[model samples]
Target chain A: MERRAVFKSRWLPYALIAPQVLLVFTFFYWPTGAALVWAFTLEQPWGGGSAFVGFDNFAAVFGDPLYWASVGRSVFFAASATTLAMGVALLLALFTDRQLSGYRAYRFVTIWPYAVAAPAAGLAFRFIFASEAGILAFLNQISPGLWNPSMNGNQAMLTIVVCYSWKYVSYNFIFLLAGLQAIPRALVEAGAMDGAGVLRRMRDIQLPLLQPTFFFLLVINLTESFVDSFGIVDIMTGGGPAKATNLMVYKIYFDGFKGLDYSGAAAQSIVLMVLVMALTFVQFRFIERRVHYR
Target chain B: MLYRERMGRAARIALLAACGLVGTVAADAQTRTKFDLWQGLSGDLGERVNDVCKRFNESQTEFEIVCTSQGSYDAAVQNAIAAYRAKKQPTIVQVFDAGTLDLMLSGAFVPARQLMEENGYKVDWANYFPGISNYYATSKGVLLSFPFNSSTAMFYWNKDAFAKIGETAAPKTWEDVEVAAKKMKAAGMECPLAIDFDTWQWMEQFHAIHNLPIATRDNGYSGLDAELTINKTKFVDFVKYLKRAHVEGWAKIKTRATGATLGEAFASGDCQMTQFSIAGHGTIVKTSKPGMNWDVAMMPVYAGTERHNSLVGGASLWVLQGKSKDEYRGAAAFLAFIAKPESEEYWSTVTGYIPVTKTGFAAMQAKGFYDKPTYKGRELAIQSLTASEVGPLTRGVRLGGFLQIRKEVTDALEAIFSDKMTVEQGLAQAVERSNATLRRFEKTYAGKTLP
Candidate 1:
């Protein structure tokens, strides 16, 4: 009788969830499947039907050095941005979790950058980094022979990395702060009673407790870094100084929208989607097991 | 039951009255054929268009013309295509020059010549400039679209910067330009010369000025099977000059996407000189504040090659298919009204676009409008654009998928500027890639050919 009652309750909830399930399938899954099909065909809007080319588009994508170069740059940007954002957010969250004065103000200020749109942040970075009359240029005017990324590729990439980190660190910090706040205070007190130092308490208790949040953050930050660099690269250098900063999404945009190579761009997009999905799956399968949830 | 019957009777009476009102409205709607116009011009130009449209709407009782701004040229084309697919396309759309081939191939445009003839409007196609009309017209010399807001390239310079560099006249040739650039650099200016450097301006005008083929078969006007021929010595020399300018700090290359306004940049003395469209003259004048000295000049020519005139750059109005007869008449009338002498004069004076009709230019000239010092050397640009023979290369590029090909050219140029590839290598790659694009376009648009 209890099993029957439980089954009946579940059925009601499942019935309640049916609409959302159908919505997702119709909107997301259906379009994604169609795009996957489109990736293999030569399709034009008013032209005749698309034909199956059997990996020809994919082969073209793989053969192009520019595509691979963009992939490499995207990986570099994502890795650098994700690492910097996670590290800075962790530090800021630790600092804000303390019983220090004006912590609220610091927290508010730290989280403020998150409120700005990604494109607006890119524009701000461009103004700050512009060579002719940027803030950095003004600073260089006073110092003479300071860092100028406008004419240098490595320095330009560094500037992009720094800008990406600046824009996203606040978001990670917000998540980390919330994660830290959720941990019981007694755990830290118990560690203190056991004669653990601040670093030990953080490393052993706090980090372990925040592992689940950290994993979620790690995935989110990686995706954000991979995807959001498109706007930054477009607004900042437009993959300039010899394509130093052309990320995958930006390349897709250029090929698809700007260059009007719809098939080529769709193929590139499929590859990118597969790569991201594989990475995300690996993160979930292998990395999630290591994330402890106390 | 008696109360329910009474309520039903009252509801029936209300429904009958509503039907009668709707019947009148439907009759009114049937009497007036409404035509939708999608355009990209905004600000003052858009307002002028609206004023003209308002006059047209008031001048007729059988048709109503509604105009809408659809953001940029590219956006307008995209929206038109999407709407075309949905069978809800507008009656008329203003497409940029780059979008011409795409529209021509789409087979959705109702040729303006046919529309005008069918609607009983008199169109003297011969009165239009041959060089300009040939670009937007069919091979049989029929106008496919109304030529509106046509412009050619012009050089703009800061007089103050020129004085500072000890130069009193505009550069007349590429060699002269190089010399002036060096002088400007010596005078402590960072960017002696800057150009928008768009693919259309740099490559297209390069071919135009040098009388070199940008593509085979008269830039694809003969057929769809044309290939790119822009990898010759003339283009190579041009790129080498640009590279030398970059290396020596005589010129600064900025992306067309991110570059500030040429006029504002020149006025502020950020750049000593710039090459841009004549259509920007109005903005140049407006942005040049009090005591700021700036002047217009003809585009510099290559020293050795035969100097051919530049082609038009702005958009033309295309009439779309699937409009009612009355709406077509209204569109033709609106076109004729805008093409009238007084209207063209007012438009040219307000905006910097050239008058489409000869009478309009004569009217402006009769008023001694060019005598104003502020308008100094403005006629030189027009005269230069009208100079010499309309050579095969200088006529205008009409290659299918020209827009995409231009982007590839821009990519190649950017690669060269960023030192990823040498000018020769970039040009070679650009030619190869552009040929591939042209081949694809030919395959797709097989039977389409210019008359």
Candidate 2:
């Protein structure tokens, strides 16, 4: 049987969703449309008028070596942050799924980090990892200059990655926990009747069953790592000791806001939007086939 | 009951109308034109800016000035640009030194001289310090902005630390700085000479003191096609020197995250010496521990060249266009009042910035303003900026996109200091990148020439 909530007046449905449609059109589609226009034109630095220089801005962005380097760095940042966040989240979810003491408290504590803003989390991590007057400062006291993130590129990158992962872990944990709880005890019991151990049962049954949740978390985490690493990179290292943590998003902000190159920044953002869209597309097309919905 | 309610409502309406009439009449009686001033200063600096506006408002009945502090220098300039585009900019904006070129080229500003003259005020344009005036002047030598708080780079060192190291005098040259830094290091100073993240102390001060050009076309004062000449100059040698100091543990680079202001380190006796803006003197005097002896000296020049004057580092006030005539008059009155010797003395004495005009300097000296213990070494800033006659290059640097260029230079120096690249390669790459940005800026302006 087919069932639906049919409205007597067509205007009722429209009126009900008017606010959402208005918000999406005003905020998202409007800005996206403006960025597209700017991406194709060369804007005057100060306001007067802009010229239509189709594809020139994009060409300039693509030809820059610094842009290419930042793209490569963004991929590394996203991949590492996603993997670390999701891996730790999965481990915590699996452990908390068991009958443990203060399970409610543990779940609450695990999800608390996601509530903190990214820049605040980055600032907190910065103090902890600072070369002077921080925990790392104490570590450096034992071995002089051991953890100077200010001067060391690798250490700077590590600081940004750790800060970003710390924020995303809570988000991944919630979905993973729900997925773990949704798995039936009968499936594990059946595996046990087949003389399988706890680890073996989890490997064959629970792991396969949790694929959809894992896939969803992976996509969300990867997209987040790509677009939202700006605040972390900005507060932690400012894309330095020497552009060490110059993620694409930070580059876009630095070039646009600080550098005041509007057209170039717009062009770079256009590229970023397309890149993210394509990445999401590829994930759904290839990886979705393996995800078990039930 | 209905009749009583209606009567009460009518009485309330009559009272409201009477209050509105009185409010309008009172406002009309004052007949004061309101002017908006947008500045980039907060905290102590913001207080000083507000104090000036308050004083001006109190001194007059015809006009009122309202000042708004927009947090940081960069924020002020960026916001002003956005506001100007939206045709909602204030009458006056305080733009920092690095943003001078961008503001000059924006074409949305009425030159300060023109504004004042049009409003029937006569200002002694030549009374301003040449080093300060030249930075904010047109190519034809006309003043374009009112220099409010001007400062120059100088060296500050701890007197107690020097005494402990058995050195009585401040370092006068780079070689002397190196020797003093080594002695401080040997004397158990952890950060012997602290380096701030600001590249101006290293690049602009060094180049100006050594009488070297930082860019072609008279350091971009002549035209828009000025390419950076830093790579060709002795700036590389200076970078190499700084890098060597860092590697040998005599110098520590202080970033904001690292809590690197020299004032703190000097107060704690960790850093023996530092090079920073003379305006930082006020901060040190205010924040440093009691009885922490310190003095300012001229920035260290190179070994061979005689020291030239250093360029100014503080901000200036510009009159933006597209404002009402009444607002312009109010702004002009405020500027004229601020240019007086009394106003200048109050500002310079409270802040560490030097008075921009000769008359202001004279007035402050006559009143023994610098005779106080807290004002010690404050005069070194004036001396440093006016050490010699202002030359073309020493006048100031004016280049489009200089803020970004400065970041590039700082990044390069950081890379070199961190051993990620050699000094030669880093400087060369910085010059190349800066030139590219300059070319883009030139293209943006197109057929028009930079004034």
Candidate 3:
């Protein structure tokens, strides 16, 4: 049976909810509405005098090959970062759940990376991968031309991906661990008694029950990798070694903030917003059907 | 006894209140007009800017200038623009060479000449170096921004590193530089030369010194519709040479992503030779170890062509519009102060940049400023910048979308160095993409012709 509290006075409920409604309208809907309007116009670089250009900015953005290249890179980056973060988080969560030696320390340390800001973590990664003085500089010591991210586009991309994933792993770990703890111990034990090994127990009993959590984390991580990778990209490679690491989000930041092309940036942002909305829609519409929520 | 104690307490309270009132009134009377000056210099140069502001503040009681460092040049421009939109802009803003066109077109600036004249200060515009003035002046030969901390690209070499190869003279041309690099490589120097990520030093300075037009219509000085002629110029050959030098392990390219700068590489003796702004001289002096000897020379040129002057590389101070008359007067007073001969001498001595005024140079010369060991090679920068009569190409490129155009050039060079694209392909792509950006910028202005 469902329980509900019916307000005796309708005005009381409306009064209580007014602040949140006001906040949502002010912060979210207002900016979104403004961006929607700007998406169709040509804004003067400074201020005042914007003309309605009707999709000209969009046409220009879509026409650029570099923009398309950045889009492809963004997709690859988000997918890879999501998979790596989730896989590592799940593995660590499982191992720590066993309460092995120093499990408390492991638990604390696993979630500590989330406390670091993205740009700071990116800076740390830059130091770690520096050409001559990094810990990985030993790679270059052994082979003179082997591991220079300064000149190698592939290495630069990998560096950014690693930096991005490292920050997200802690976020993924918390949710996965909570989901693991929520799994019935008796159910896992029954699977274990049936001669199903640890992997088998995890696969047959816990994994299916964790599906909803996994899907939620998937959407969150994918959205974050798309929208939140700018700091890492900015501090790590600045979207270059030849625009090889120019993710879509960084491109937006670069074009809007650095290039000062507000209308173009606004149009690109609208496209990105629609793309993410469609992605979230697909996840809810199709993928969520397979997720087992208790 | 009770009445006497109450009276004493009342007397004490009255005394405290009287003191407070007097203090408040005196403070109000002595308060100076606070002028905010935002610049983009850091390290020693940043400190020098602060010191200059302090001197101005100390020299007068009318206005107190508070100088704020805005980290980098790009950040300074972006922050100033944002602040202007919010109507909270500083009275004076320092914008670099590339940003001049943007600030000029923004119409948010009060011409420095107009401000000085309005405030009844007679600024001797002719006293400024023509190369410096030519870069910041309007097409009608009006000074829009006050030239400050100006520098130009020139050759810098490690004397000790050159000594190891029995070379006592700086290379006068690119061929000599190549020869020296080979010798330095033979001597087992890991990096014979390091190049910065700034394509301005390579394309603009190189093309200007070679007397070749970087773009059509007199290097974009004639009109805004100018297209880049960089790919057709001999810069392609220079870039190809640099690429070959990289492949041979004799050159290093310092991307902004890299934790190290070209200045650091050269100052630390990791690289023996480079062509960079003389402003980097301050950093070299601050960071170099006791025995690391270095000197500046005229920038290397191509084999047979006669060399011209290099263009100015540093920033200038622009007076923002939409300020109170008092604020404009204060800003004008500050400009007039920095332009003084003594102030210029102090700035040139501290920052290693060229003095902006003729009187300043003459003052430094009279003081034997160039005779000092630390300033031994700095005169070469002045010579390199003012080597020729200020020509249209040498005045500087005033392209509307210059910041984006510069990024395109850097990205292309990076592509070439990384072997992702051939030199020809990379430069051609840069030209095409930059032209598109130019078109977009043109559309933004609608019908206004570039001055």
Candidate 4:
């Protein structure tokens, strides 16, 4: 039975929640409202004044083919990064949950990469995968012109997807591991006594029970990969040898900050936010039905 | 209620003390009239800027110039714009060449001529080389900003490598460059010419030197609604030639994409010849291998065409408006001090930037400054800048969204080099994209015209 606490003083409860409400309003709602206004107006770069353009900025943004290309690239990046991140994290979580020897150290090591900031990780990966004078340089000696990410677009995409997945894998592993541990140990032992192998037990007992955690990670990773891959893309590809890696978030930054197109970038932000919100809504409405919860 | 009253009294006492401290600081600020200058470069160049401020500070007691580096040119301008919006902008800022139009259109600064003349300084505006001044001046021939850290493209060749390939002098034309590259390759030089595909070096500078138009309306100096002309120029031929060079393996790509810059590739002797700014002279000297012999010359022109002056690539100083009288005086004084021939020589000597005025170049020559091995070959930059009269097409690009245009050109180059798009297709596509950007900029400032 769930117990609910009743407040004797109605005003006291409102006061207790006021700070949180104020923070959300100030940080999230205020900036979002400002972005909405900016999206419909033409902003002067030097702040002389802005004019009300009324959907003109959005019209311009949607009219550009390059903007649409960025949307496609961002979708590809998010899907690839999320699927790769969750698969790797689930694998590692499964390994650690088996209570193998030195599992504590392995768990600690797995979680360590999550603490690294995104850009720093991107820079480290950039040097490590550098074609000419990096750890991968030996591949060039073995097969000349084989490991050139700077020239090739597919290789460039793979590089960022790998880097972003590496960073997020640790985050997913922690959650998945906790969820794995929450399952009663007797459930697994029970499946094993029914003439089932380890993989069989994992498929029937562990996999079905872990669906809730998997669904939660899926929604979080997909939404975050849309926006949070900016640092990785900025450091590694910088939107490309041919705009191959120009994700929507990085494009927004480049146009607004470097190109000084404020209204156009604001329109891009609105599109990105709407896209992410729709994605989350779809995942909850359809994908959540398949997720089994106790 | 008694405790709260006691706490309020204590807080009021602290606030009074804070106000008193602020008053003293404000009084000190008034006495010195310290003004801010936001420069766009850092490291060794930043230290040189700091040294200039220190020298100026020591020369006077009435005003102090506080110089700060905002990392890169993009950051400096972006931060300055933000600061302007907040009414906290600096007195002076260093803006790069591409930003000239945006600043010129924004009406945000006091013209250098007006500022200098108002401060009782007789600036010989004509003495500023036409090639340098034309880039910063208005259509009415009014100078908009003070030229600072000026540089132009020059061809840097490895002397010893050229000698091994039986070349006695640096290449003066593209055919000569190709001949030298072929000879070097035969002589076991793997990467004969290192190319970075920098927009300023390849697209803009190439167009300027070839006396070709990059955009209509005299490269956008005539109007805000100017369109691009890069597709209808000799640039298409240059791209075809570059593509051929890449296919033949004589021109090796050297940029951050390849994990080595053109300057680094030259310094390490991985490439025999490079085309970059004269400002790279100092760093190349320091980083080159011991006993490595190198010299620089003016960039090559096509065999049939007359070579025009190459556009200056570095930044210029703009005196931002809306500062106090004392602050403006301090800024004018600092500008005057830096404009003297000796100060120009000192700046050029340390930083490898060419002196902006003819007098500074003459002063350096009279003193045999270029005869020194450390400073040799840098004179070619000045020669290249003054190679011909500043033609309408060669003055400089003044279009808004020029930085994006440069990026578009770079993307075109990459696509061409990768064989994903033909040279003609890429150039034409880039011109289309650039025109779109221009149209958007035209809409942003609908009623404004070029000053």
Ranking by lDDT: 4, 3, 2, 1
For B21-125, candidate 1 gives per-residue lDDT tens digits of 779655655677788989877656665666667677766677778888774676777788778767888888988887787777667888888888887878777
Any runs in candidate 2 off by more than 4 Å, and if so which?
Answer: A1-18, A96-99, A178-209, B1-32, B257-259
**Candidate scoring better on TM-score of 2 and 4:** 4
Tell me, by TM-score, which candidate is best. Answer: 3
Q: Residue by residue across B64-123, what tens digits does model 2's lDDT show?
A: 898888867877888888898888999999999888886787788999888988999988
Off by over 4 Å in 4: A1-15, A189-197, B1-30
- Cα lDDT of model 3 by residue, B1-451, tens digit: 2354466467559867986877865464357888889999865467679899989987888887879888678788889988988899999999998788767777888987788888999878898888888889877668899999899987889999999999999898899999999999999998998886587788899998988888888877667788888899999999999989889888887644555678877877888888888887777887886888888899899889787878997899999888888888899999999999999988988787889888888888889988987787788888888899888778888876787788889888888887889999999999999888878876776766654
lDDT winner between 1 and 2, please give it.
2
lDDT of 1 by residue, A82-130 (tens): 9998999999899899757899999989988888776667778777776
The predicted structure with the larger TM-score, 1 or 2, is: 2
Q: Give the per-prediction TM-score of chain B.
A: 0.88, 0.92, 0.90, 0.93
C-alpha RMSD for every candidate: 8.4, 7.2, 7.6, 7.1
Q: After TM-score superposition, what is the CA distance of residue B335 in candidate 3 from its true location, in Å?
A: 1.3
Colliding residue pairs in candidate 3: none
Tens-place lDDT per residue, model 2, A61-145, is 8877787888998999889999999999888888888758888899989999999987779878887887886777887778887
Candidate 1, which CAPRI tier? Answer: incorrect
Model 4 steric clash pairs: none
User: Highest lDDT among the candidates is held by which one?
Assistant: 4
Per-residue lDDT of candidate 4, residues B140-170 (tens digit): 6678999989999889999999889877899
TM-score computed on alpha carbons, candidate 4:
0.91
**Predictions in order: lDDT:** 0.76, 0.84, 0.85, 0.88
lDDT of 3 at A69: 90
